[model samples]
Structure formats: C-alpha cells, structure tokens
Target: MRHVLLSLGILLILTVSSLTAQVPRRSFLFKDARGELAQARARGEMDVLLVIASMPDQNEQVAQAIAGLGGTVQFQADEVDYIRARVPVDGVEELVSHSAVHSVDISITGSRAFGMAADAPVLPNSEDFSASGILSEAVNPDTIIWPPVLSDYPITNRYSPLFDIRASEFLDSNPTYDGRGVKIAMIDMNPDPLLPELQVATDLDGQPIRKIGVYGTAQDLEEEDDGRWIRMEDMVTAADGQFTYGDNTYVAPKDGTFRIALFHEARDSLATFGGSLENDVNRDGNPEGSSRLFGVLWDEETDDVWVDTNQDLSFADQTALTDYNDRPEFGVFGTDDPDTPIRESVAFGIQIAQEKKLIALNLGSASHATLVVGAALANRGSEGRFDGVAPGAQLISIAEGGSAYGQIESPLISIRDHGAEVVYFEQSSNITRNYLLRDGRLVPTVIYERLIDRYDPVILSPTHNYPILGGIDDFVMARGLIGINGHESKENFFINHGVRVEHDDNLLITGGYGPMGNGALKPDVISPSNYVSTALGFIEGRA
Candidate 1:
C-alpha cells in the first residue's frame, strides 16, 4: 500500500512540474547583454566601457568591431588596459545605432569618476565577484600545484666564438694553437665585465695574468709610473736572449727588443705617442724606441690591451706577456668626443699599430664605409664592386647598427701602410639596395664581393639561422679563425667547418661547446667569449 501511494505522488508531482516548465527561467541572457553593450558603444554613451563577460558570446561583437578596425585583441587580461588600440574613432555614429544596451556612460579609463558611476572600483580583481571566487576555489589542486612547464632553452646561436693566431710556422704547425699569448681585439657594442677568460692568460700557477698596459673607457690614465717598465727592460737585457716571466718580473729581449701590450685607452696613448712604446729609459728626458705593437687583448677586468716589441718576438714571446696597467679601460669604444667618438677610437687604434710597426694588427670595429670606399675605387665604376680578403691583414669588426663605413676607412689605410699583412672584416652591415647594371644585365649588387675586391680583404661571413651567431657555411670558406657560440647548431657548424672544410692546423676558434659527439670538431683553439663574464655599460648590454 505504501509503495502504491509513493508512485501516485511522484506521478502527480511530475505532471505539475511539466506544466510549469512551459514558462522560461528568469536568468540573464548573454545575447541580450551583448546587444545592450553594442547599443551603448554605438550611441557614444560610454567613454571607457569594457565588456567583462564570458568569452564566445559576450566578446563576439566587440571582437568583430575591433577586428574591422584593424586592432588586435590580446587574450591575456593582466595587461588589457595598457595595450593601445588603433581604432577608427571617426566612425562613432555608426556604432551607436546598435540596440541591445540599457545604459551608457563616458569617462576616462581607470578614473575614479568612471568607476564610481559604474558602481565599481578601479582595478577590480576578477576574484571580487562571487562567481569568479567559486571558480577559483573549485580549481583542481594538481592543476594549481604543478603548472605546465614552459621551455626556457636559450635561442640557438646568440653569439659567435672565434679562434685567432699569427702566421708562424711554429704556431701553425700544431693542430691546435692555445692562443696562449696572441692578442685578439674584440669590437662589439659592449663587453661584459664578468668574462674573466676573455682577459689576459694566467701563468701556470693560475694567478691573474697582468699586461704592460690595460686600456678602455673606465680606466683613468696613470699620473705616475712605477719602475716596472725600467725593470722589465732590465730583466729583458739580463735574460740574455730569451724572455722570462716571474713574480712582478717581465724580461725584455736581450737584443734590445722590448714588448709592450696596448688596448682601448692605451691605444689612444700609443697613437698619441706616435706609435712608439713609451717607457722612461734611464729616467731619461723622454721615452724611446718604436716598440712593435703585436696583439690586442679584451677582457672583463680590462677593456682592451695591446702588446708590441722592438724586435721580432716569436708568437710564444708575445703570448707570455700580461697587462700591467693600473687603470684599465672597460668598454669596446671609449672616448670623450661626443660626435664620432667610437670611430675615433678605431682610428687611434690603427694609428698606434702603424707607429709600432706591427706585423699583424688586430682592430676592433668594422666600418662598411671603409670597405665600400675601397671596393668602389677598385672597381672604378658604380656598377662594378670589389672587396678585400684580408686587406692588409688587419682584423676589423662591424658590430651593431652604429657602424659607419665612411668613418672607418682612413684608419684601415693607416694600418695597411704599416706592416699589417692580413685583415679580417667580421660583421655585416647595410648594403646597397639597388640592383647593379653590369653589361646591360640587371644584377643584384653583391655588396660583400665589392668590398672584398676593393680592400683585398679576408672576410668571415657566418650565416647561421641563429641570430648574432655564425654558422658552418662561414667556417667552410676560409683558412682563418672561427668563432662559435654555445648552441648545438653552432657547435656542429664549427666542427664541420674546422674538420671538413679547412685542413689547416693553426686555426684558432673559441667559445663554449667543447668537442662532443662522433663527428664533433674539437676546438682547435679556445678563448673565452660567452662563458667569460665581463662588465657592460647600458648600450653594450643591449647589443
């Protein structure tokens, strides 16, 4: 009897509910709300109105309008207001004609007046709403605790590693030259201070290797000189024929040959001294002898260092020297001249190398103007172009957009006039956009080719998919140095370029990614670049 009664009651309730179901529920309709917003915006009734409703339905109309106006809608809410939208404000009348709005208000975005009028506050948290709070609380614990991982791998080929050395049978005979004392001038937008490996080499005892002079932007020229220069000369004479290194002891060559290192600020001083190595001999009236400037050293502690000697020192002898400047410059381009200051630095560097009678000059900063001028003159016609493949054997660099070809050539000519035999133009810049008319044939101007022919320059053009890094194609073409950055792609490029392309053993290359894998090309030589930390100025860091 109870079961029958319950069944009858359930049937009666169902019938009543079915009849009542004919009436719609009194809930907010999304379409209706959206229509209302459209009408308000169309009527120009809202100054800063944002529709904060569900996606798909609520945002559909607004999105359409924004799209038609050539504006983009970002999904992220954190920075919605900060984003500027270029909209057709002139079409306000057509927008106000839409009908689904209940009210419209006009006010500045984020203004108290706008918020108060809308019965809300500026910068309202989405969590402030009950519905949003409930959703937040209902999130799955696992989703919150362990968010999906985002890849953080560094982009491949952010930098190029290079190996450099002088052309000596002893150094060239070996498969790998350790770059023990070869000075490499690095011209870049900025150099980091933490890169210790980029600086002078240490003695076998692992102490910081000091040089004769350290130069760059931050260094202050010394007002006083210790007897170090005199002592070094004395030691050189005492050693009879060979150079020796000891605690605070640098021996000059016994044959009246003196080696001194110059860099950044020191380059300026050397140029000012007319390319002569300045050292008080016998506390005499003036410094004497045209010291042979050989190499350029760049490091985090010291911006730049140049080394030179009077006698033809072997590569090993030059490598054994260290920077001894108390106040070392600390940047790539250093000068007080506001206009063309950096260019002046390069000019000064070249002048000093010339005066010192260096066999090879390592210059930082490559100016396209210099290369272009050389090319234009060599080709004789605007349509024809030429370039240098190690023009005069001086290493030059082009880093960043500030590079100017016109500004850099005079210095290059100066270096060439000196004993510099091979010049490497590293770094690329803007080339002529026009097509070259050659024998009535319209050909794209080969900027690099022209430059090479003009300067008779040796060029290193690395074409890696990675930005700011060189690729394998660059290494395959030449017998000179190779620079590799840390990246599997770049490492592979370096390896292939070194092993398969150039069989020369004296190749010097540096950077992270030491040899790994079956076909990996072990670095024939390595020097600090990316891994070596160094101080950087604001612009340098950006570069």
Candidate 2:
C-alpha cells in the first residue's frame, strides 16, 4: 500500500509540472510586418505588432524582421525584447502564431506616426495580445482643452488671414447687425459662473448690457459666490413653475446691447460632473446637482422657445426688435448636448429669423434637420443673409448633420429650395460614409456645382477619420468657406480605427492631405484647437 501511494504522489507531481510547462512562455515574430500592416489597413482595423527577444540578441532578429516586413527599423537598447511590426486586426493573430514572434505590440504609422509623442510597451504573452485593450497614455489637445470655443471666425485677426480678408470684404458695404440688444438663447449643460472675456453685450444699435439672469435648481447654487448666487435666484424666478413678472427687465452694458434670459433644467440630482441635478454632486457622499441647458430665446418669441424657456417672450416681440432682411443672427451647435432635440431647436431658430426680419441667421445645431431647416430660413431673404459668399446666405452647420444620408439630403434640399447663397458641410470620412453609403458616388450635380461656383460653399471633410475637432469648429470654417485640416494625432486614429499608424495626414499623397496645401489648397491655413479653456456650464457656488 505504501509503494502504491508513493507512485500516485510522483504522478501527481509530474502532472502539475507538465501543466506549467505547457503554458507558452516564449514570444514569436513575423517575417513580413509591412504586409500584415497593409492588410490591417485594408480591413480598417487596429494594427498590433509583437516582438519577442531578450536583451542579448535584440539587433539581429529585430533588424531581420523589420527588413523582412519592408519597414524602417529603429532600435533602442532599453527595449530588450524582439521588435515586431504593428499590423492591424486580421494579421495580429497570424503574426502572434508566427514561429519567430515572442509577443505583439501596436504602433500607429501613416501621417499621424510622425506626430506621435510616445511609444507603447511590449506585451508579455499572447493572451495579453489584445489590440483593442491597448490604450494611449499620451495626452491630446482635446484632452487638455475643455469647453471648446469657436474662435475661427473668418473675420477674426488671430487665425486664417484669407478668411479674414473675405469677411472684411463681405461686411464692408453690408449693414452691421452687431447682435446688440439681441436676446440670444443658449442651452448648455451648466452656466459658466465667470462671464467670458469675449462675451459681447452690444444691442442691435450697439449699446452696452448688464445683469444677465441665470436659473437652476436650489441645489445648483451651493458653494457659489455672491454674484452667481444672486443671478441664479433671478433666473429661477423668471422661468421655473408658476412664476410670472410683469415684464422681465434687464439692464444692458454700454457695449452690451442684449438681455440674455438663460434657463437650465436639472435633469438628475447627481453632483458628479454629468447628469441631472438630483443625483450626487461629487459622486462621493455629497449630494449635488446635474442639469442641462435646454434652449435659448434669441430676439423672437416662438412656441418652441417659450416651451424651452417657459417664458412669454412671444414671436411678435421678437419681430418688433429686428428685421430679417437687415440684421444677421448666428447659432453655435454643441456635440455633447444630446438631450435637446436638434429638430425642434432649429425650427425655433427659423421662426425667430422669420419673425425678426433679420438679414442673416448663423446657426449651429447637432441633428441633420436642424441644419436643413436653418439653411431654408437663411435662404428666405432677397439680398440673402450676408450678401457675401452666403449672400442671403443663412444656415451653416459644423457637419452635414446625423449619420444617415437621408438626413443630410433633407438639409441639402432645404438649402436648395430656400435659395441659400452658400452652405458649408463638415464631416469625418466615417460620418460621410454613413451618409453617402458604401457604393454611393458624389458626382457634382449641376445645381450643386452652380451653388459652389456662385457661393463657394466649403465642405471641410477630414479624410482622416477621427473626432479630434468638435462640430463647432467645422461650422466656423465652413461658414467662411475655408477648407483646412484642424488637428491630427495618432491616438485619434487608434480611438477611431484599430489599425495603428497605417494611414495619417501625410498619406495624402497629392499634398491634398499633407502639411502643405492639399485638395486644391483648400485647408488654406491651420488654427489652434489646443488647450483651449472656456466656460462649460454654471455651477451653483462656482464663478
């Protein structure tokens, strides 16, 4: 019996050892890294390359693999393992299975490759060979910048000069609206306690303004300073349940001409960074507020604006203030404000333009219908909105609006019917594909070309697929009818397409996509969209 037990114990020990040994420890390498990379790019997947080598023999195998893969090889002594080519999706598993491969890592190539600031570490095993799991540790401008502001106005001195020239020429003979005394409505997640340095307060006649009322839940006022606290109170009383004042009066600053009645809805109670005001404020133990800005009432009173602000501003009052054929109105659309239905918001804008008799309307909205409707209203004027490129020009959007082509067509048709002077369409390639279908073609139709020839409508479509820039930037550039690529980063590609570094801005072979002027010198110049800090929403106690 003792002898049998001893034999069983030995067998158990052997089984355990074999199990550990069977766990693959060595990394493998692929001979053709470039081929794999190309394959991944073709498939539109993230590229991952695995290298398996020890400190002693880094050069020989790494060099051979890179050369074999038809790619340039650079070596760092600090990196002891084998160097592997980063190939996109399909080829990753095949590369991992290669006899020479030890482990795989990802590297982005193409135009974004030169600009990448950091490198990824090598994975220890095939099980950890998840291209999707790999995350970029690098910080991007968008990451550092919050509350993106649209400062790329063609007339602005800071950014593009060509656009500035065009704007000056257009506004020279035209009557200036000045947005003075114009009541502009803005729906935001929260109000910035600090009024922006660039905040304009002029009335239509170019007067100054003061005392902008802001309203939110009672909890929204916690920790707010004295000024913000008073503002919040006034705002709530003006819009909240069953509250009425004879006439909501506001004092405009000398340079400020308009009174802004801002309304916010506390969707949740959470105080963290997002959601309704009813949710926890800190997401810690503290209770806080979450609210979203719904809509703004410009110079008119429409049922939509009234419903959003819960005020009796009325369309007639708006019409009395401004003439649609004489003044210009502008709209700025935000990508994050999903709560507000873009269609209703845009319809409200059209109504405001019609009532106010404004010369031009500049609107920004998220959904496709908003862009379409906004364009239609802008086209209503005889002299058009601006009398320049968009002469009688009206609607300008950041992108073509939603993902579907049908949605885009709705706005396009609206622009045509309304006799829009010009309209700018901005979108990423992926967004465009979603709109233009896989097999669809975008040949220039006669009417479309005629509009382009007459109005010079600019479409800023980044062939590179990514969300580096927000929708507002697109609209600003489009309005000026200036074509330019804004921000380019390898991380954006990784975030959008799994294939790392396969294609980049540099890949625009015809200089149409490169640093220099690409696509008929369309992107006339570059503007800064980095580290920009702007007001997000109003915090109760914060200013």
Candidate 3:
C-alpha cells in the first residue's frame, strides 16, 4: 500500500526501491553526450529521447528551438518530464545544451532485438482434437466431465501446487473475480483472432465478449516484399540438351556479413535441397517442370556461392564463386540426378532462404502471443482440456514493429483507446547497449514512470534472459513497473530438455539476477514458463 495511491489512480507499483533507497544519485555531464552526439552528427539526423526538467517556459522554448532546427517533437510526456524528437545532427548539440534538458540519449527505433523467441516451433494441434470436441490425451473424450478435475493433467495441472500459482482454488472461491470485467492487452507480434483456443466467450456481466481486438499498424507490413516471386519457367534455360539454372537480381544483405539465396520452387524432400538418384531435384524430368518456382535467400553468415556445376551432387568437385557485385546468376546443374540445383542454391547462397521464409511464415511471435492469451483466459467450454487462470477476462492483441518508441506507444493506445486494464508486453525495454541510461533520466524510463502515475494500469514485462548485474534495462527499473522472471516448473526440471535448471527454485538458467547497479532487483516477480501448452497461430494446430 505504501507504493499505491499515486496521482489520480490507485495502483500497486511493484519495484525493489526499498533495496535501492540508499544508492547515491549519479550525475551526468556534457561529456556523457559527446559520443552519442558524434554518432547523431554522422547520421545527419537522429531520433532522440530527452529527459527535460520541469521548468516554466523552458520546455516549450526547447521544443521551439528543436523545430526551428529542422526537428519535430515526436512525443511528449509532461508527467514524467520527457520529450522524444527527431533533430538534425547539426542542431543536436544546441538542443542538448538547453537548460531544461536533463539528459540526452538516442531513441533506439532501429533496434531489432526482442525478448520473444522468433523461432518457436509451431506444434501440430491434431493430437489435442477429437470428433466430439477439442480434448487433450489426459481426458477421456467418451466420459466428458464438466469443469475438469485437477487429476486430469498428472504432470502439472493448470492450477495450484503443481503449476505453483494456485489458480484453481482461487477461482473456486472467487467465482466472480475470475478476470470478469478486465481487459488484458497483449502487446506483442501479430496474433490471429480466429484461433479456436484464443476465442473469447462472455464477461461476468453476461455481455458477449468481443473477439480479440487487434490494434496498431505493423511498421514492416508495408515494406514487406510479398509480391516478389519468380516463376520456374523464367528461371530455367534449355541449352546443350540440359536445363541449366538461370539468375535473378541479388538483394544484398543489409549488413556485409550476410547474403541470401533464392531456392527453386520444387524440392524432393524437406531435409535438403538436393534430390536422390530416384528423384529429379529440379522437377525438370517433365515438360511442365520449367514452370516451377524460384525464391530469394539471404544468408547472414557468408556471401560466397558454390555451385555443383558437374551435376555430381557434391560441392567437392567445384570451387566457391565470388564477384556477386558483377554477376548475380549462376548456371547450376544436376537437374537430372537428385535435385542438385536446390542443394547448389543453398551452397551458392550459403543458407536456405526458403527455410527462413518458413520461419517467417510460422510467425513465432504470433504463436507466442496466442499462448500468452490462452494462459490468461482460454476457456474451452464443453471442449475441455484446461481453463486459463482468468477464464473470463477480455483479450486484445496490439501488434507492434521494430521501433522502440512504437513499443511503448502501442500499449498506451491500448489503455486509452481500447480500455485495457492490464498490458502484457512481450518485448523488453533493454537499451543498455544502445545508450547508457544513468540515474534513470532516459526517456523510456521517464515515460514509463509517468505512464503509471497517470493511468495506473498493471504493466507486466519479462526481465531480459540474462544473469548480469544490469540485465534489466533502466526503463523497467522505473519505480512502478512489474518485471516478471520466468522459472522452470517441476515437470520441466524432470524433463531436463537442455535447460540448466540452476536457480534457488530451479528457475530458468538464463533468468536475470537482481540488485542492478542502483541496487534494485531486476524482476519483481517469478512465474513458471516451461511446459506451457497453448494455441499456435498461422498453423491450424496447438502443441
């Protein structure tokens, strides 16, 4: 209660401030901004998050000056006292020199690192289904009981001592309090609202619960090359009685370290691009094989290409080819033997772009968001497996992109426009490597601090999966944020699926430890993360 009742709302801001109260306030000097300013100057212009002191006309004058210098105020949080702006590099020094500006740092809009796993496997839901309804192997579909008993999932029930949260008994006692009137906003990647497991029922008031409301504009959606496709006929050339591989313009890797390779549309197997003696790799065995398909592949590891020009299905006979800057096409062979062209494509690009495409198609973040929603409020009705912790809570999906500012902005919009009472963000605000956030004067830190004071919604975020002293970012270190730590369950500990299981409570090995530089614990709470069964998106199955 000591941390509650802030500003206009009543909220419990869980933080380890009591443990860090005695730490001295660190000071920032002009020299601290030198490195960042130099980088901004090199870029010509940059987006900056400025922590400004609450002064009379000073904040407005700073904004005016920034605008006059070819910059725009992107966002402003008066309560936490911060301003986000895109300022020209020539004027960044002038902007930072303002008396009202407390601290200056770059807004990491370009940072792509996220806490959510991008490659989480999409499991088949066939096993969890039956003609009668969706039921797990744990339950007897013939018997069909209502409000399933705890003994069903012998490994770890979705409730008490086994899962360690005790939601079963709590729901049994507080029937009306099972997230009845709450709106939980899942701020993560794209989540399909049509999934059966993620479907919404009704609220406590018996009003038909709306479908999971998807919010936000995906920044990458417009830039995505969804129309980039090559027909197989255009890729194959018939010369010398053998069909040879053609070429396409190469899309260079954004970073010099990587190059992507496009694959042929037809393949004999999923294991490798090459075919066997029994099968035609390029499907060129038939008259219509010329019209197959081709795709783009960019390998971030290497840029060299190796073609099996001899058609023996072995790269050992040939040498690696370079000079991609001059020629983008390679006349690969072995359309006759096993699908050697596919293998050559992989070797040529050094990685499978099609496999990367498959990963993107799977949409791990979407599946992850589905799991998060199901874990909170999945109720199968007569189709019984296990109910979520809050089976009656309303759900919303706020899809976000790579922008750091968009991350916070999405949740704020959810709370304001969609009436979200609880926001579960899948990404961490870890800008420690991008910019130093000393003394909690960073823009994200200030914005989070003020957001809680103004709205007082329950903001939940997972701590970065690192064990360093400052593993938790400075923004999450704000006074009122709830940082969550994922731990291993008894089932996961026994399964021993490569997890180190090395913590006081057998938590995750990569769980971030506490007592940051400011002496505050990184995570305010720990919860079970392993062995969770939830819905998958982009695929018609659940694991």
Candidate 4:
C-alpha cells in the first residue's frame, strides 16, 4: 500500500510535464537552417530537437506533437524543461515554426564535432597496475573516524569522505537530521546492492528504511541470466578502466586492521589515486613511500600490506607492508552482502537508488552524459578524501537509469511518489551552452522561454554541467575548469576544474563561442573544483 501510494504520487507530479506540441516553429528551427534541413531531407531524417519546455504540461504536449508527426522521442525532462527527439524531416520547418515551442537545438554531435566518432572509447587501461602507482589508496587504515563518528565514514572505497570533507564548515553543524523519511534516487548505472556501503539501518525514528520500489525504464534491452543488462559489461567498459558493477562488497577492516586501498588506473592519476598507489597525491606530501611498506596492496584476511615498487603487481616485486598503507585508517569496511542485479545494470542504477541512503552514479564515459553528470554523487572531501553527502540518507533506486531527461524523471518521480526527501543527481545535459546555428556559425541562445524550474532540495555535485542542482550545472558548465583542464593537481591536492583563486598556474577558463543575453555573468559561484571524490566501484571481477 505504501508503495502504491508513493508511485501514484510520482505519477501526479509528472503532470508537471505536458504531453503535446505547442511548437513555435521559429524556436525550433535554426537561423538559416536550410542546409541542415536539406541534408536531413536528403537522408530522410531530421536532427533531433533537444526541446526546452516552458511549462508543467509543455513537455508532454510537445512530445505529443512530435509523436503525432511520427517522430521518436529520445528523452524528456520536466526537471530542466527539455526533450531530445527526432522529428520527421519534412515536418522540421512546420514544427519549429509552430507557436507553442520556445527553443530547439541541433546537436554538435558528430565525429568531427563535440560528439564521439565511435561508440567504443579509447582510454588508458584501468587495471590496478596499468598506471603503476594509481591502483589503490589506503582507507581508514587506522580505523580512525573522520568526525569521530562510527557511522559516518565507513564506505570501502579507497577514497572515502571525511567528517568535514564536504566543506570546511560542514562539521560545525550537527547532522541532527538522519534523512528519516527522506528518499534519494540515483539515475545512473546499476549499483551493487551487496556492497556493505549500501546497507541501511532502520531510520533513527525506528521507521524501516528499505526499498519501496524498483522501476526499470530500459525494459526493451536484453539482460544476463543474473538480470544484468546484456550491455552492462560493455557500457561499463565504455565508462572506463576495470570498474565493478552490481553491489560493492568491500570487506570492513576491523579496528586496528590496516589495508591498502586503491581504485583501478586511468591515464591521469586524478582519475585513480590513493594509498600507496602514489601519484604525488599524498595528503601530506612525500607519500609515505614503499620502503615504509606503504606501496599499495592489502590482504584483508591476513592484515597484510604490500608496496609495488617495480610495478610488476606481484608481492615478490613488492615490499611487505607494515607501513599502515600511508592512509588515514579512518573508515569501517565489511564484506558486502552478495548482490545480484534485479534487472539490467543501467536500468538498475536508478532502481538501487531507491533502497539506500546514498548512491554513486558514474557517468564519466558519455561525453554527452558526462557533460551534465560526471560520476554524480561525487562527494568530495577535504584533505584528499571523498564520501557521499548525508551518509544516513535513505536511497531509493527503483527508478530507471540512463542519459536524457527520462532518466531524471524517474528519480524526480521517486521524490514525489516515495519518501525520498532528496535526490542526488548530477545533470542530464549541458544544454545551457546549447546554441543555434546562424549564418554558418552557432549563436548562443536561450530557448527555455516557457518551462518551469525544479527547485528540489537536491545535493548536487559540481560533477556535471547539467541543471540537476537547478542553477549550479548552468553556472559551472558556462565556465568549467577556469584554469586547469580535467587533471591538474595543486599543493598535492587533485583539482578538477582548476580554480583555487589562482593556484597551480591555472588562470584561464573557456568561454564565448556565442554571445550572451541579459548579460548575467555565468557560474554564479566558483567555489573550488577539487578532485576529492568518492569512488563508484564496478570492477570487472569484483562481482
């Protein structure tokens, strides 16, 4: 009964999304879009409209129009007020010229453009030893709690969040709240339910906290015998390195137990760094080096640690570790219960969000997806650490997961339909910088003249440039990485967008492929784009 009521509530809020075309032809068509239109006609297809809706029912109304014209809708969003759809070539002009639409965009999504040339990604090996020292980082080696809370810092990822890691003053206030009735939904790949990190105790109020739903939107996709998406393994590889899926079940290190914690490797150490998997990212300089037996391998059962100096990945080539993995030994870890996907992995991401207090959704692979959400649930910690914000918050992962607004809608629905008080999603698209092609060039335009804004109390990660946190994504996307590109460290700290008030020689930010309107300086606040992130594990064989 509770589940049914919650589901219905979610359906009710979806009314905020309309289902027909109030197409404003001019808003949908590009300036002098003749060439593209002709090309579409020649190919018997048209470029998809990433529609920016202006009202509650507007999205649905416009979608109805597109379907009315026999077009296929790729994605929809009431959260950000937009839809990705492929309209009939012949109906392009008429559709865009319609009066009901506010804005439309032609994707710079091609081989030579902002999009990828191939589906398969070409990236650095993510194997533990691929990048030598970037394989792992020590986690809570001493079992010392970040905020001295036994329950706060217990995630098994090598890089877990500390008490005040979320921000400088985060610990000043009491977590007086435990997300008692709050529900959170992660719209990303499937999470391993078996991960000890995901185990949720009943709310402090004594109300049971467990999954109330599991909605899979990608029902058309094939699945493995375990119900994982047939493409789950491949899509994850497409995400990068040796990642893990299903549930993360890292063994909890007993008090006084030491462990070498490191995630897999990527080309840049920024993507993978912790413990003795040294990339010069030690919290206090010097990395506590291998001779100290701080190199990077942990034998949980034996309480053994090894350092890989030769990088051969064998204990023989390494030094036996007693060095405490050179990491803070703060968190708790335990074997996660055995986890199996209830459905395909991609679809399971959102579903799993429903049952836990927090979830880490990694969307680092899709440029399109990452443009808005890069490893969302990216909880960055101070002093080179990471953890989910609001650790005790309940997670509701029964929604579907994928790119586009449809992926977002599920979680939003979870909020409306369930007890999810907060949803920690990154973003669905970096559509803020979306432009209209005009006079052979792209013109910066705001087509969202008619949509409503979602002011959900969402804990957003500067993770993506999407509007998940309402204005944050637009602000960051407008001026992402002011100084450093993706991987530029400063003072031994991993920085993502390189803005430390002029630290590490990072002084420039990208801007202006098009002109602006209303003349508001974008990126309202440029706090700090640090690389202190919690890892989302989906390793190849960890399952």
Point to the candidate with the largest lDDT. 3
The list of candidate 2 runs beyond 4 A from truth reads 1-305, 308-400, 410-422, 433-458, 465-483, 486-543
User: Worst 10-residue stretch by lDDT in candidate 1?
Assistant: 435-444
Write the residue-wise lDDT of candidate 2 on 1-543 in tens digits: 999999999999998775333113224322233444555577775534333332233446545555555444332222223332333355455544445443342322222221223456875665434566554446355665433333322322222221422455555566453223322211111222212222223334544332121112111122211111112112222332223223443211112112234433332321222322222221122224423432233323322222222123332222222221122221222222434221112211222323322212112212222222221121112221211222121222211221222223322433433333333333323222221111111211112232333434343333233443221211111222344444433444454344467443322221123221111223554422211122222222111
Worst 10 residues of 4 by lDDT: 343-352
What's the CA error at residue 235 for candidate 1, in Å? Answer: 43
TM-score of each: 0.23, 0.28, 0.55, 0.44
At residue 488, candidate 2 shows an lDDT of 34
Ordered by TM-score, highest first, the candidates read 3, 4, 2, 1
Question: Which residue segments of model 1 deviate by more than 4 Å?
Answer: 1-176, 180-187, 190-195, 201-403, 406-428, 432-457, 463-487, 490-543
Residue 534 displacement in candidate 3 (angstroms) = 2.9
* Full-model lDDT for every candidate: 0.27, 0.29, 0.48, 0.34
Task: Say which candidate scores most in TM-score.
Answer: 3
The residue-by-residue lDDT of candidate 4 on 1-543, one tens digit each, is: 999999998877775453222322344454324544565567666444333343334667777778888888765655545566677767666656545555544442222123223366777656533345565555334664332212234234332223213442554465534344455655443343423334442366755444222323321121101121111111111112122223322222222323232322222422221122222211122234432211233433443444333333333433333211122111111112224221112101221121221111111212222121212232222221233444445555432332233333445445545545555443333322232222111111121112112333443223234222322222122121111112233532433333454364231133222122323334322332333333223222221
RMSD of 2: 26.6
